[model samples]
Target: MTITRGRFGHYKLLKNTKRLSPHVPDIHVYSESVLTSLLNNLQPLFIRPLLGPELIRIIKSGETYNLVVNDNEPIVTDRKSIVPCLIKQLHPKKTYIIQVNPTISYTPCRTFYTLQRKREGANWKTVHKTVQDTECTPRYMNFLIHWKLNRFLLAVAGKLGDAFVGCHTMVLEIGYAEGAFFLYDTILHERNSKWSQYQSFIRSRTIRPFMPHTDLCTKSTLKAFLRNYGKAIIKPAVGQQGKGIVKITIMPSGDFEVQKRNNLSTYKTFDALFQSIHSLHLSREDYIIQYYIALGIVDGCPFDVRVITQFDEEYGWIATGKLVKVAAPGYFITNRAQKLLAVEEVLSVPDSHIEQVCINGSIALSAQLNNLSIIGFDIGVEEGGKVWVIEANHVPSIAMFHNFGNNEMHTKITQFIGKRRRSLSENRKEEG
Candidate 1:
């Protein structure tokens, strides 16, 4: 095969083609089988055993002639040596060679925030900070193969969902799903959906709206809402990350009190609060006023519980993880701005009671979200054990489970995808 180089200065060799180049390197030995063998042999040498005899044999064999594997792809050993060799063997006008590198970086790609603890001789010292920067470049072809294999595995697992759903009792999920998963969980009653329908369903079945927060917009409506709950929270309905949330309380002396997150002081009247809120440019429709739940404190910081629901192959609707999110100092919402602590560590009240409340609240929330499929229910409990529904998140972040060393949630997700793939495949097979 003798061909001119492309604009990128690279020439690709077709199948079973012999190079007839005089003063250029022949680039035709890069095959998928060869790349797979190279990756399989190279990956296991990180611990103890180094390269095996077979790899050594492959390396020594001059059959590879002037080809060298860097990272994993085959490249011309030396442009001078290989070019001269090819030129002498087969005469060609010119040649172009493509280079590939494959190496996994030991460091993470993104700047991840982590807490570090140190011990001075024996006791622990204050946490310090660190930064890590490393680039990992995996062999492109091999990476694609691994990714496809994982996808295939997920497809196979998803087909077995029916069996799993029949056997499992509870399902906990913490991820985003568009519509299919929601339909499946709701129709099958397999997992909590985390949608408003769950709340409506629970309210219809139980005859009580769970944590019905007042919707006060006007001054008169705000006064009425305040009179009902004594303490109310003004929040944006479509808001997130705890922004635009204000806590309001009515003083016994007939004056109004207001507190804003991250603020050091409280306001005594609506005028003072409205001035602050107005400065934020909040529109009437951009905010919602609700009864505030005095979530119990953990280490002097208020915290809330997040109960995740998912559908498993063996279990229908299961509570996967119970996480206690403690708000940051002077913050109102228990989000990433807050510290993630174990439920046991953050539960300030009695263990038995807290557990019961969490279980009951989770079950109720799950049953409500069941109509939706994947859901995260945030529940707040007061010091006196008054439990209230904070909110429901349809698309909650799953990164927390990655921090906790439990990837079962990911497995379930893969399984869900697999089942859907299998179902589609079967339908196509039937149609065909």
Candidate 2:
């Protein structure tokens, strides 16, 4: 994660373009002739396709060759078909070039981070450190897999200046990105987004609830929703760790109740409820009101299922992991301090069907999103085995998985991400 150019004495998320390190080579530019020249200059570069296994390489160390998607295929590339072939097939963004031998299975390089808790303050900090996997700790484009814990210090002591210069990954810190929350909510807008796309995917009896919306929490807006649903959730437009969420429950007689973490209030009028909310330092403009999902309960508290997904061009979307989260007593959110269960332990739906529902939700969500390939989804199940999506998160915390002792899911996640990254890297082509 990024550790520089911060704001507000904290590592705030800023909208910035990612640039390659000034010390690295300028090899991001891609084109047919440019790629060929790069191959000649770098020697032994290969062109690939979006689908199927094929390698376009120089033949017999000669400049002349046929460009095809598969190594065994004999289709010849005409002059006009070279670049157009690429443009028509591969994804514009997911594609990247790797210098390693394409024949050997190589995993995409990834960075890992942990939420370092603050000792004195009531805050969590995203710290950049080392991560270990089955194979290696990815340092940007290189692997620290075999390196010792003090490898950097050892390299510095040996005066190997280039040792640490080109080995680190450039990761955008995700935990603090409030702008992404607002963006996801905005994309849930009916006009431009795939809210309907999700509908198209899961137009089944199990799709049990209305689509969620994000709106300003004005008195009129709140009252209008209360009049219709009698219950709704209020939360900040951009928040994390489930903080500042209030559930409003109104009876037919207009008696209203507001509940939050460890606190509850009963108000005689809507204005009084709004005033009570304002007294807690929350403003209508800063928050959004949405339908309060009637989540299935575990023990005595409400809970939701967290499904983690990875995307691929061939397979669409795949669920890597899922967890049943039980909210702490008196709270409506299953944030960091919550308990978790296996999906089969609570969800009445068949395990396979529940997984398929999660997969469909992830695919629809990824269709609307641009940057994230790994997404965390919060889903709720009702009494009739119907599932409703609560939220989609780009920077989802894996703390719950770790806390629940579901380490196998974490391994599945690591493997899926590595494979997905490699797939995204291979399918580099111009947008058609």
Candidate 3:
């Protein structure tokens, strides 16, 4: 079984299907003439790379066109100049695709939902209809019905499933435009979904407020962010165990200080600073740049809280365990820690507040995606007692509890796991 990856591959899969072809917007390989033609025909269109997370949207406004890259502000350009502008901004060798941007009802914001679907025997089911992209709690099926897209989206899912071999699950991104719903994108693999963690959480109302400012790292973005915040952290887009993490700070003497694990390097120029980080991180692959939260200190070391939430068949989502990971001496990341303390022992805020936030946030997250029974949230607290969510782990390790020697919390987590397993067993028995 062969599975195709990348946006262009999926586009081709749908384009060849007579029934699904019309639903997909007209997409073409990037060229000056092709782009110019698209601009003339479509008022608003999108420019996406063949592979990667970069997106460029061009919208017509009055006599000029507005180019919006990712979440940044729009840059105005005339029709004649827009093509050149993109060429200068985008990589020279990488291929890009231009497509007609659908006229969705709502403008792009911090919120969007994923339509989770899974193949059951010979059929595919839309398990999660609305991942709560907006404030109103609309049933996913009902919303699709209102837009008259219930059948269309389902059909798209089935077709894509058949096209992607050995793929039994998918997350569809649906959009409404011109009184019809269209497939905006598809998460065909679990790894792709995991890479979308930052994006998925930022859309949640419960989690967005607590999320620190985060963006993909680049030399320009890194310099601008550091100039504004004076400190920032760079992390691999897909990484674990706190490895490959880098922190940059502007010292009192105005030099740029970079820290990885416990070692520190200082540079006098932004160029030199960027080089250190680029060689250490950026040149290899994508990394996330986030505003550094001055974490609350515990025993002269910064620490962050870890809250584990699990779903109970009878009770919904619950915060089963909470602990603080204090960074070892001379380190900022709490991944490798010297001490593990109870939340109450370290945080000034009431224990209830932390639990409530974790539970509520987890519930909001569960609504966004499917097949979520457990989640571990990394919570950060500043010196001023404010809480921020650093990251949400989909498959949170129970080893932390065992390592901390909190048998009570460890038992609670295992009990929830056991209950979920038993529930699945009974369901399968009934099916059998």
Candidate 4:
């Protein structure tokens, strides 16, 4: 019998549908010597099984380090004693690799900073520099993946690290849930019942003027909002990529104006306009009705700035980059498909002024969000240059920056990650 994919029990369901930030941890390949050193450090270790959640903690006692697993008792042993057991009992007939989970809390020294020595011509010894960028970057440390144990063997590069000197000093959490350790957006989007909770968080940012949203549950709700704003947009309370959105403009002439992805329509009454909207068959109360701020236009196209922010263990909230996205002419939505421009070229106002608002606004919102790794905000400026936050995304695409060909912004962001890793390495040592 043939089984259909994504039908009934065949498909997987997630409690949290939110996307985890695409960050490749700086993990090093494991080896014999590195494993021995890690044991001496008494570092907490995790042994992650393939296709299962990783181990949570590692406890060290003198020469032995205990590997801790979730819902399971800890495995205790030292480097010399555990070595034979690992190679013989664990992986006697197979070969595999392991390393530290960089995002884990117990990494030694906790920094991504490191020293490197590369061979030079004949007798010049080797070249060395701090790893500031991924290009020609050096691994701070390396380890072996214990396949049999299903746990990663982390390389604990000690307090001073690798018997040499290097710089790349700093640590920042690009994005992660705060003290609660879960992303703010994941908690917000996982349930339809969370609407009030998420809205209240936004309100706490003092964003009432920027995002004027009200229930769009009943006909009276729609009519009241129409009468109040004259122009409003209907959107999914939870959505992405500019789908299922409609902007309605109630003209002074008593005609309703509506704009969609493909067509524009006008209706004489709110009932008639909402009837057209009802044809889409979207669930009520699943959407929101919000006043549409007249966006700042460039060359007759509505444009907005998208700002990306991340938390550093050292510096706290940092706006890594910001760029402008302009919708195609007459297109109300801004995605990568449309044209993109530098913020300076689009905003007649000083670029710093705009950036500061984005930076400060993002921080204000992030402060209340636990383990906020990164968030992007869509902000618009009125003709008079007044600021308004259009929307926020937990996982925002960075196509605008790539489309604009801004390497400087890319470099700065990567550097922040590198620094944050370095600082984490240092921070872990202090905690130990």
- TM-scores for all candidates? 0.44, 0.49, 0.61, 0.50
Write down the lDDT of every candidate, Cα atoms only: 0.42, 0.50, 0.73, 0.49
Window of ten residues with lowest summed lDDT in model 3: 109-118
Ranking by lDDT: 3, 2, 4, 1
Model 1 agreement with the true structure over 225-290: per-residue lDDT tens digits: 776788777765455566667777777876666666766445677656555544442332234456
Model 3 residue 267 CA deviation (Å) reads: 2.7
Candidate 1: stretches off by over 4 Å: 1-202, 206-212, 251-257, 264-268, 271-284, 312-314, 348-371, 405-432
- Tell me which of candidates 3 and 4 scores higher on lDDT: 3
In Å, residue 190's CA in model 1 sits off its true spot by 23
Report per-prediction Cα RMSD to one decimal: 24.3, 25.4, 10.4, 22.4
Span of ten consecutive residues with least summed lDDT in model 1 = 47-56
Clashes in each model (backbone N, CA, C under 3 Å)?
A: 29, 4, 0, 36
- lDDT by residue (67-170, candidate 2, tens digit) is 43322343455444556656754567634331212221233232222222212122333233222122332333223422322232222212211221211111
Candidate 2 backbone collisions, by pair: 54-69, 54-70, 95-428, 140-169
By TM-score, the candidates rank as 3, 4, 2, 1
lDDT of 4 by residue, 313-382 (tens): 7777778888888888678877533676778787887766656655665565554344456667787787
The positional error of residue 409 in candidate 2, measured at the CA in angstroms, is 1.2
